[model samples]
Target: MDFYLAAVLQGLCFSGLALGIYLSMKIFNIPDITTDGSYTLGGTVTGIMLAAHIPQGFILPAVLLSGGVAGGITGFIHTKLRINALLAGILVMTALYSVNLTLMGRSNLPLLAFANLFGNWALTGSQGPDSLIVLLVITAALVFLLGYVLRTDFGIAMRATGNSESMVRALGVNTDRMKITGLAMANALTATSGYLVVQLQGFADINMGIGIVITGLGSVVIGETIIRRFRVVQPVSVLAILLAGAVLFQLALAVTLTLGIDPTLLKLVTALFVLLIVSLPRIFQSRTA
Candidate 1:
């Protein structure tokens, strides 16, 4: 039970990443690989700040800024330099690796001695329940705020920029700025995931972001599958579905681990699971046909 609980907490932590991926891939139709880097950038910033005895509340803006900058760089490269979005993202992600290392001054930094976001919550004399509640609140607030944003005029423009860039451009929407802003916001959320995870795990490592994009992608894929299955068309409900998908994805992995799968094979299992989610509908349709 505790193992599964931990998995649930992890899913909550990654919810931000799932939201980020949803924005970039689903909203903007850009496969921004910057997720792999900006995530660790969040952790790196948090680790350094906490280590310096900074207030946890004061660290969030820094994390968001770092992540946003990383993403913005990718967007700039893609839009201004006329590079492929994927390649531009890859370039920024690769650069962020060194940036994270340089900022941390090492490959790994232990955060066990620092104050975390949950330090103020002393309920039940155990961190689990408190952390759970806090995460739930945080996740809910994020979804609500994001939903509201998506309904605003600027948000509609952002969506339009993604859905029909040429059309939005013709309408004088400055599609280029929209793309940059969208990527920046997406990576800011991704970085926040890193911020939460590093504090939860009590450590930050340069390699922590490696393959992290797959986790977010898997969650989005699962959410997308559910949305399609239920024919859920409401925008806010779609966000809720994606958040639920993050938790469900983690639970699936926990069950796999409980079944005695080798821990080292977790990544492979994740990949296969995502592939299955992505291919299942096509397979069913073919069979029915």
Candidate 2:
């Protein structure tokens, strides 16, 4: 039971990341590689701050802002300098790798001895609700916030820009600003997830974000596959799909683990899962046609 609960908690953490990726990839039509670096940046920043006696209450917001800044930089380069979005993301991600190292002062940071965001509650013998409760709460808040934001006027403009930049520009909307805002918000959520993850795990590893983009993209694809047939889609439904995909992905991992699969091969599994999910629609369309 504990193992299952832990897996679900971990899934919720990854769900936040998946939501971020979905915003960039699906909503904004942007292929962002900066997520890989931003995830680590969030963890590095949170872990270092906590280790340095910073108040745990501020760590999450700090990490979230750092992520937004990192993503905004990439957006600026892409929009202002007219750089390709893909190349811009790669450049920002490359720079963030060094920045993350500087933030941690090393390749990793240990938070085992530090006061974590949930440490006080845990110390007070609040065993009824573990860190999992915190994870769920954070995830729910993000979902509600994002859902609300996406329904606003600016959000509609952002969505329109994603569908047709030229059309949005003709409508007197600043497409560049929309792009930057969307990217910044997406990466902020990604970083926030990383921050919460490290707090739960009590450690932050620099290499923890390896293949993170792939994993996030896979989760989005999986979610879309599950929810593609919905007749009436809502933001809540989309959020639920994202979380469900994360849980399903973790279930796959659990199955592999039970089968004695090596942990290192998980990346390959994620890639394959993405490939299958992405191709399913085309396959079905062809069959029906």
Candidate 3:
């Protein structure tokens, strides 16, 4: 039971990454691979800062900024250099590997002895309750903020840009700016998730981000699959779905652990889950048609 609760809490921390993935893939129609790097960038910055005794408030914003910068660079490459979006994202993600290593001054940074965001709660024997409270607060704030943003005029322009860049450009909307803004925002959220995860896990590893992009996409797909009927409520529905997916992902991990499954096989499970979710709609549509 304790393991189950822990996994759920951890999943909530990762919900931010799932949201970021949804924004890039669903909203912008961009297959952004930058998230794999940005997630580690966030964790690297946050872990380093915490180890250096920086205040928690400062660390959080810095982690977000690091992600935003990495994403913006990728966007710039795609828009200004005429690079294919996938290649541009790959270039940025590759560069971030070195950048993250530089930030950590090593392949991994451990926060086992450092002060974390939930230190007070942990010291008071309230870690579980406090973590749950914090997760809910952050999740609610993100959902509301994203909902508001997606309803704004600029948001409409962004959605239009995604649907048809040429049409949006003809309408005087700067499609390049929209792409950059979307990517930056998406990666900022991704990094924030990384920051939260390291705080909860007590360590940031250089390899921690491996397969994160797929995992994020998996979460998005799983969420969308379950809530496909809500066309008007897509954003909110996707958010709920992502949160639920994260919980389910964690629950699966817990089950694997209980079954004595090899921990390393977890990534394979995630990939299989993603494959299943991705195929479900097509399979169903074909059968029904």
The numbered model that scores best in lDDT is 1
Candidate with the larger lDDT of 2 and 3: 3
Runs of candidate 1 exceeding 4 Å displacement: none
lDDT of 2 by residue, 1-289 (tens): 5666666777888876899898899989999999999999899988888888998768878998999999899899999999999999999999988888887878878889988866666633554256767777778888888888888998788888999999999999999999999999999989987987898788998888888888788778778877876643788778878888887777766776768878878888778877887898899999999
The alpha-carbon lDDT assigned to residue 137 of candidate 3 equals 81
Clashes of 3: 0
Model 3 residue 67 lDDT? 93
If both were scored by lDDT, which would come out higher, candidate 1 or candidate 2? 1
Task: Please give the lDDT score for candidate 1.
Answer: 0.94
Candidate 2: misplaced stretches above 4 Å? Answer: 122-129
Please provide, for model 3 over 97-163, each residue's C-alpha lDDT reduced to its tens digit, 9 standing for 90 to 100. Answer: 9988988889988899998977756533678878877787888788778877887898888888888
Cα deviation of 282 in candidate 1 (Å)?
A: 1.5
Alpha-carbon TM-score of each model against the true structure: 0.98, 0.94, 0.94
Cα deviation in Å at residue 102, candidate 2?
1.3
